[model samples]
Target: MQWNDYRLVLAVARARKLPEAAEALGLTVSTMFRRIERIEELMERPVFHRERGIYTPNEVGDELCRAAEQMEQAAFAAERKVLGSSSLVSGTLIVTSSEVLGAFFLSRHLTDLASYHPGLDVQLHSGNEVLSLAHREADVALRSSRPMDSSLFGRKLSDIHWAVYGDAKSSARLSASSDFRHERFVGFSSSPFADHMSAIQRTVFPDGIVSLSSNSLVLTASSAQKGAGLAVLPMVLGEQWPGLFRLTEPIEQIAGELWIVCHQDMQNNPRVRLAFDALISGIERDRSLFVGDSV
Candidate 1:
């Protein structure tokens, strides 16, 4: 089968649902259905068992998936090598980060980078999901955790401190009592960091009620500002909101480091290297802000 066919099978196997797989490959569900049918016809066997809109890959499908994964890795390595040898500083540079950091802090620095390199195009993808540098999902990333992959390069920017925040009234009310169990909180919904935050809440204040929960830190911070409840937020974000007050000292258990990371293969590319240096310098200049000393 062709590479496209292999990719289609892999996507279907990964997503299980036709619509999601189609979305990942930028194809309509109808198109995906048709393509799969054609693939099955060409192979003279069924690759997937379809039941209630879910696709489960059969043995042949599993074999194809393994081969597809190998092909994908080889292609990515080839692309990385070609890109790494390039000395050109002009091209698209995709930078990924958490929504809060991208909106509140990283955007300005990215704009400055764009201005400095007139030929370079800077794309900022802000989300809670950690994009893979090895997969080339993003060229660089500002992450809460360091890269564990040996194929990637990571630099610790700073330790990002977390603290409880609330509006003036909530802060006053909470301060009146040492018992945190009686208080309410604005917590995170489903996200990469939500489970960790939930664990911290359970351990520190098991009886505290989550009055509001959202995946967006910006929304959680806004809820706290409006007195929805106390929220655990990064100090850089919590301090910037006008109506919010830091209700507690930094919570060491929930604190995490900020990292600037990229695939080792892309590290030597002039554009990637330049962007890395710029981001490192910018983060260094604001180290106090990240570490909660600026407030």
Candidate 2:
């Protein structure tokens, strides 16, 4: 009947363990049991099917759970909306970006922003896959290229250059010559950049001696460091290790247009605005890093 009681049913059904759900809600196990019993009494029907001390949502319970989830989201969104209207530049902002840039660049910038506005909190979704802003999956996107979604808007920050990299010791012998036929490359396992990386591979490693592929940029970097072979890496991330050597100038075909994107509705939200400005300011300050000019 009550919102908090609905939350209890949802939590319990989701977790499937009374103790775990109670622990999450900061309530004792006995209290959780009583609350569930009370909810059943008020509804005049069983919400969960109990078997072997595990709770599974029945048909009636499943419908209630869905409603409870929406209610919870609405409550949180309302709280965020109220905070966004306040003068204080603070609230939770979920940002998505590629692991390499998110970890190497944006993370530092977001940390600085957090330090400046102590109330601001950031949830970073770092990976090779891009999240859709229209789905409310992310508040902002620090990514290469503008979104195709017409409802989204963004500003180009800088150019991200890519280059071939290899181990400092072994790569000393690398050249874009017949010898290239003998070389190996570490490439992306699963990424939107897969086709782009393949294009780079065809140009430099024409022999197609790709030794291994991974989904993680860090692993790719490490592979290059250990002489696994040459790798196409973002200039900013590749230059982090002295043991890795840039084999050539920025690869034009693999170059990326960096942008900060958000939904149209979020354009005027104060917290999102502050965070967006911070990203732009930070990228402008370190523009050279993106273009392989500084490192």
Candidate 3:
């Protein structure tokens, strides 16, 4: 099947419905269906099972989808490599990091990095999910801990410290007491922090009274500032919010090093290298802030 047709099936599998996939690909539903039909006709078999608008990839479809993905990546890599040879550093730099890191740190510096290279496009995806560098999910990643993949190269830029924080009113009311069980707690919905929170529940808040829980640290910090409960937040973020106050010192076990990671193959690519260096320098210059030292 043609690359475009293969992509159509891939999109259908991903979106789980022909109509949605068509919308995403900017094609009419009939056009999308006809394209897939042509693909299946060429293959002499069905690739996907359809039920009530939901499309599930069969074995053949799965294989084709994998091949299609590899082809797409190869095409993109070719384009990137062509740009890499150009003296002018200009291309898309996809950087992934946690919501807290992106919002408080990297996002602010991205504009300046792009301005330094006018042709560069910066896509800063703020989420906790670790995108695979080896798979080319992102050009570079800023993470709390070093990547486990050997194919990746990384630099530890700074230490990220976590501390208990709450609204100023709660701090004023209950700051004297070390036993925080009397106060409501705010915690993450998921992360390596979940285990740290377990320790906290056992040692600090025995009642397990968590008033707010979310995947977004931004929301968690806001909740704490509004007096919802006490939340464990990155010091860089917690300190900047005037409504919030640190309830205790930075936690040690839960703290992790801030790392800038990327695929080893991209080390020589000018845009990737430049963006990577910019990230390291920016974070290095602001290292004290991440470590809870006020600038």
Query: Best by lDDT, which number?
Result: 1
| Per-residue C-alpha lDDT of model 1 across residues 164-280, encoded as one tens digit per residue | 788989766666235577688998888777988888987877889988898888989998898788888898788777899876767778778898898989989987888788778
Overlapping backbone residue pairs in candidate 1 total 0
In model 2, the clashing pairs are none
TM-scores for every candidate against the unseen true structure: 0.84, 0.74, 0.84
* CA lDDT scores, all candidates in order: 0.85, 0.80, 0.78
Candidate 3 local Cα displacement, residue 8, angstroms: 2.1
Give candidate 3 misplaced runs (Cα > 4 Å): 76-86, 129-137, 173-181, 190-201, 204-208, 293-295
Give the Cα error of residue 85 in candidate 1, in Å.
1.9
Runs with alpha carbons beyond 4 Å of true place in candidate 2: 13-24, 28-31, 50-55, 90-98, 114-141, 144-153, 176-179, 188-206, 249-257, 262-266, 293-295
Model 1 off-target regions past 4 Å? 17-23, 26-38, 169-184, 189-191, 202-211
Question: Could you give me the TM-score of model 2 versus the true structure?
Answer: 0.74
Q: Give per-residue CA lDDT, model 3, range 111-206, as digits (tens).
A: 687777788888888775778665567888887777788867788888888777888687777663466765688766676567666676556557
Screening candidate 1 with a backbone cut-off below 3 angstroms (N, C-alpha, C), the clashing residue pairs are none
**Consecutive 10-residue window with the lowest summed lDDT within model 2:** 171-180
